[model samples]
Target chain A: MTDDIQSRLDSIAPLIVDGSPHAVALGLSLKALTPGRAVMGARYDESLIGDPDTGTLHGGVVTALLDHACGMAAFAGFGAKDTPATLDLRIDYLRPAKPGLDVTAEASCLKSHGLVAFVRATAHDGDPDDPVAIAQAAFMITKASKLAQERARRAYTEGRME
Target chain B: MSQVLIETLMSAPYVARFGVRLERKGNELTGVLPFADHLVGNPLIPALHGGAVGAFLEIVASASLLASQPLQRLPKPIDVAIDYLRPARAQDVYARAVVARSGRRVANVRVEAWQNRIDAPVATLHGHFLITPGQDDTAAD
Candidate 1:
């Protein structure tokens, strides 16, 4: 049963990136995944620059990345089959990310008590020690597998969107 | 002054991607995130992505900070915290920001976004921004 559940999660986990419109548009990719962890990445794109003067990537992009990473972590924490809804996310921008390198976020599920799950994540360009931003978040885990499959079907089959 | 700030913010490519419109009446301002197919996160729930919602609220907070002061350049984000109250439906979303405090170097702001009714908010964001003082505050006014 454990092996079966793990295999199912492995099959469905890719949907987090492939099924998301905003994530795809942002060029987010899932680089790493585990039972209770996920690492997502987005390379620097000139189109995402908010400050035309400085060419700095917009803070909103960072927020979106962190939020998605945390949610992924929570989802994985609940056996990777349960969907996690973000309850709260806090981010601290330690510094402006360099415009040239790819940015990646690594998130871990700190704990899941009852219906709520706690998560922490950090965004870095290359070096984990020098992180661009750090995030702490919480998510609500419920019937994720059914909801995720339904959304995927809606986007792929119905073509309305996912 | 707010008009100038709105124009500056709306011109940014990132903010323009969401087609966010700014409506201001004095200090109180509202940000509008229109409905679009690209904004959906979960098609099963037919809801807006949490990242989209978070980005929208953050943009509102940044815009509010820009409009509240007379800074020559856009303020940089220091940190932000967001609380999701409910699943955001795939529809037009609106947000309002309040400048809690504005110091010489930093400013704190709070933002709330709602759909369907203003009384209920789908998400809330509280954040701090780094401010650059203008050469002359009087001329900015």
Candidate 2:
């Protein structure tokens, strides 16, 4: 059963990221996905630098990367059907990301019950042991999100979205 | 001096890309995030991306810190907690930050982002940032 869900997530992961305009703007790509885990990547771009003097990527980049990865994990945890909205997110910046190095986020859904899912994630430039940031988030399947999901499904079926 | 600071803050590569602008009067600063197609996260609901809203909050927090005092460089975020109170609609968003406390090393900030109504904020953020106080020109030498 889990394997089936994993495959389903794998098939839709690329489309999910592609459909998000901000994700596309930042050039995010899904690296891996499973039942309750997700790995995503954001390549280094000079245009995203925060401090010109240090050439370090902005903390916001890490924030967005972790949020998306955590959201993906929550989505998979909810059986990859329900569209969950983020309730809250907390992020800690462990260190600055080096210039010209891509950043990757690995997230796992710790628990899911009722309409809420909890997720934790870490962002690293290269070495997993040395993380750039850590994030914890809660996602809830709201009425609005469910309606939005239905609308998206209809759009997809109608060939409005590619 | 304040105008120059606001200009410097908006000129950052990422902030410029988002078209974030700061309006400063005296020591107060307010952030404006204009609507753009690329800022959409969920096209179905047509809501602004949560990540974009979060980033904007952080930018406003840092801007408040810069406006409150003389800083050697932009403040570095230590950690941030953000709560999504409501879905940000696809339109212009505004934000204001309050520096709760500032010392030699760290500053605590709280920010609120609202769309049409100021009473109803779409999101709120609380964060801590590392800061470096600027030295006087004579002291620098």
Candidate 3:
């Protein structure tokens, strides 16, 4: 990838992450973004614990993180020009994340074609060797999403709203 | 008897954050996820986040297992495959889980989530969970 493309992706990555309300609710942050790849992090918080007794993070948290990470990878794989919708997602819980530890997901677009992309990602706390979960997902550029993107581009060009 | 168990299961910290609740009629359990601004993934389409919908399905699956039988602890998800049929609109979402098979050590569940009409499910989940049947006293419920 060229420097210009990398810089453009970097600038737009945070917009995608921050624009999502659920991502904000979960405190997800875009750590890095490159062609066909993205790294996202979620801060550890008490309210997100699934088991009060065990203090383990909920499996749903991992699901959401992986979903967002994989989506970002797919978006980048499309050169950050198109936003895709998830078709299906499969996740395997390898183990419980230790209490009081933040988690991160590293996702990469395995392949991309006309309108569909496949992505894989792994979630880990601090050690990449010990993954908490792994996810495989497929994303497609739907008609509704494409129209929405066009409208947003037009709005941006006209400076109607930031 | 099962209602009490369902309440306990829904009281989990993470599940409570999203304000998910289960309504019971006879032996059946229906899950409701009230719409919230924080649940939206695409403000452009203004649709509910796929993650929120997926997590809600998982919660309903576990709750169904708990309502079915007494368990030593909360069921742990082994693996889950979720198919998104439509973009979930920003509104209250409802779901019901059907236990396809419940073995001694593992349970297979299917979940359907919808917003307006039950026939039109926005997403579906097929998953397996690890469960431990209670010894005796726990089974009384």
List the pairs of residues colliding in candidate 2.
none
Docking class of 1: medium
Residue range with the least summed lDDT across 10 consecutive positions in model 3 chain A? A153-162
Candidate 2 positional error at B53, Å = 0.5
lDDT of 3 at B114: 93
RMSD of 2: 2.6
Alpha-carbon DockQ of candidate 2: 0.78
Q: By lDDT, rank the candidates, best first.
A: 2, 3, 1
- Return whichever of 1 and 2 wins on TM-score: 2
- Expressed as tens digits, the lDDT of each residue in B1-141 for candidate 1 is 444555667877788887898887866778999998888877666778888898898888878877776776777889999998878987999999989998999998999999998888899999999987565344545
Model with the higher lDDT, candidate 1 or 2: 2
lDDT of 2 by residue, A1-162 (tens): 998898888767767788899999988899998988999999999889887778888888888889889989999999888879999999999999999999999999999988999999999999999999999999999888899989877877887775
lDDT accuracy of residue A125 in candidate 2: 96
Q: Give per-residue CA lDDT, model 1, range A1-162, as digits (tens).
A: 657656756776677787778888888999877777889998898878777777788888888899888888887787765677888999999999997788999999999877889999999999999999999999885465357655665555665542
| Model 3 TM | 0.95
Candidate 1 backbone collisions, by pair: A83-A144
Per-candidate clash tally? 1, 0, 0
Enumerate the chain B TM-scores of all models: 0.90, 0.91, 0.92
lDDT of each: 0.83, 0.89, 0.88
